[model samples]
Target: MVSQVDNVITIARPSETPAPRAWQRPFLKWAGGKYSLLPELDRLIPAGKRLVEPFVGGGSVFINSDKHASFLLADVNADLINLYQMLAIVPEQVLTFARRMFTSLNSERGYGIVREEFNAQRIDSIERAAAFLYLNRHCFNGLIRYNLSGQFNVGFGKYRSPYFPQEEIKTFANMAHNCVFMNAGFQKTLALAGEGDVVYCDPPYEPMPGTAGFTNYAAGGFTWDDQQALARCCVAAHERGARVVISNSTAPRIIELYKGHGFDLHHVSARRAISSKGSTRETATDIVAIL
Candidate 1:
């Protein structure tokens, strides 16, 4: 039976075992990351030949899951995909670069310089990857925001010291060896799913009442049309015999959209971490649609 906390639903499978390695943790600190939801999510994810995540934010699900199947991780953010690709191919180099940033250049001034350089878009792939990681770790609340011109604009978090995810990156690199990274849209990425594949999508959630929206991480933010299009993609993938799982806000429109398509919907309580006011960090209901 599914459990409910307030308006949130929780599904727990008693047979699931604990994760064996520490390396299974996500390498990045993402705002809407599913790290906290991993336990409940474990019950819903089905075993398949390949795991495809169309919106692999912080890769919490991918990093923690069993590695029996290969992975196809894609995101519309080219910088994010490029970082993952580099991590998969040259883990040691990436680790070295990150360590240098953490050890010698982790101050506010250092972060500002790197952020400026990254915004300028004049750096190479490796440097860009390193800067992405650095900014994400050092940025305010791990938020990745962009201006109308597609430049990173989040400010520093001002923490005395932020933890560098060296071990997490190593683990991600090792696991990513059997994975394919793509810088493509969700529809295109979901099209690659076929029979014996499992697809999990965690798109930007619809904003709750009196809360801020965060769909602008990319230049062109996800709109209502994009959400509807995503539903169609999930339905098509399921029709192709792929097990599809999607997570989004428990908005009325979202419920109507997935339910109209005959996808089984579940609810879960999600904590808001990116709000400007601490009082606004209340529990919010989210939906999990399994097709």
Candidate 2:
């Protein structure tokens, strides 16, 4: 059974149609991606005037949900945002560059060369976007990590071959034709979200105690302070009459932080995929807060 928050009445599943439209999927493989939870998210999402996502990692929620009156998608990761912007504006060119890289490179050696060039900043935005896509598809477990200097540092996955989602890219490009992309902090993005909008926050999960959390997706990794700032932002957005939803680890601090903030909280089971040990990769509870 699907988990729900805030006593939401689950919408009945629609009957099958003879020719159902193909659902678009996220083109990037993001850690902590919410693609699997789209159905639950769809139920909570009020019919939107605009959809604002400050942490649009992999864009799983955005791609799976219904098109809003408008969209404001932003992230702190410039390259990721640039990739989406380029896809929306110059998809054919991005696709061409991606195909060339995919056809000409497959081995660890080839990946190393591309990674070096990507880090060197010797290519144009379109080519860099294509390289980023290639690296994400072929990287180890689709983990996007950066070094202290903010360089792409994930190693190759050594797969026999990786499938490039050319059609998915085109689909997303068309879908995001009217969406606005920004490389801004979460607070700045949320500030633009106001009445008649839905804001979904999927910030990096608060790390478990005594463990170095996976916040290195970009420079200046998210900290507990950032988490508190986000909670305040969510409250501000709620006060402004925007529907807000947030996903985070079921950490005690997280539970306590939002408990008295007039938000409904529920726990849902989610898979842990980023673990290096197969034994450690198991289902865990994730908290969902609806305001």
Candidate 3:
């Protein structure tokens, strides 16, 4: 019931894992999802000081993170935050929403109705959360793409399926009960700083000059200016004694953006399988800041 109005960074060391619950599905099809790289995150940060993630995409890390100050989670996407809020606050509503969405997902008409329900209630934090899982379960490629105007644009995908599993709904709901979800910008979440808070930001990456077409998740272009602003906020948090981790493109400009900012740079491989031609895109890396 409390809110983080001031910036207090806390670094928490995660040495224990949460007891496993049933909800076991990734809701959204996040681009830089940490499902595979979880061990790496645990190794670098290890659930230190008040666990915080501003960008908390897909929640692979948050759900998996070692228990900290409960957990503080936030995101700019209203629908996404709604899902978290439903999970944290009123989990049964999420169950109803999930059941309704799944039950009505067979035909195109039913899918459209479900989508309408999601878009219509996206402004409601809890509903948006349940709708998030619903749409992501039914959307094509689990890809959460938005048009320039911010409309969910990805169509249905290959396999005839609904990604939401039966038991996962309740499991995820239980996990949601442990954290606080906010439909706010990443800064608000990062601003919540006290000693030992580990803040990981996976904001939209800065596009390189030569790169052609990249996936755009929001209506906003996630411009260079936004990246710069985020960098400044992160520096401020770091100065306040919070440990920070950020994932960004490997472009020279992106690398320079964090230059001398006190982050230990590590080159990590990324498989750009969005197009799924199965090609490998090397030179991807993660920037870790905790000094």
| Model 2 CA lDDT for position 56 | 93
Q: How many backbone clashes does candidate 3 have?
A: 29
In candidate 3, which residue ranges exceed 4 Å CA deviation?
1-25, 120-128, 212-215, 276-290
Query: Candidate 2 at residue 218, lDDT?
Result: 95
Model 1 misses residue 236 by how many Å? 0.8
Model 3, span 1-291: residue lDDT tens: 333446765565666898754333464577667765666666666456577788877887777666465677887876677666666677777677667767766566666766676555534655566666766767665778777767777665534666566465565666666677777786677778656777878787666678754537666657777788888888888888777788777767778778756567765555453664445444355554343
Q: Report lDDT (CA) for all predictions.
A: 0.86, 0.87, 0.68
**Candidates ranked, most accurate by lDDT first:** 2, 1, 3
Give one digit per residue, the lDDT tens place, for model 1 in 23-68.
Answer: 3568887888888787778778888889999999899998888833
Kindly give the number of clashing pairs for every candidate: 0, 0, 29
lDDT of 2 by residue, 1-291 (tens): 355679875666767677834556788888898876776667677778888999998998787767476788999998899899889889999999998888889989999999999999999999999999999998998899989898999999987878899778877887887689999999999988889999999999998767677887998899999999999999999889899999998778888888867779978878887876668887888888999
TM-score of each: 0.89, 0.90, 0.80
Best by TM-score: 2
Model 1 residue pairs with clashes = none
**Decoy 1 TM-score against native:** 0.89
CA RMSD of all predictions: 8.8, 8.1, 11.7
Q: Native-vs-model 3 lDDT?
A: 0.68
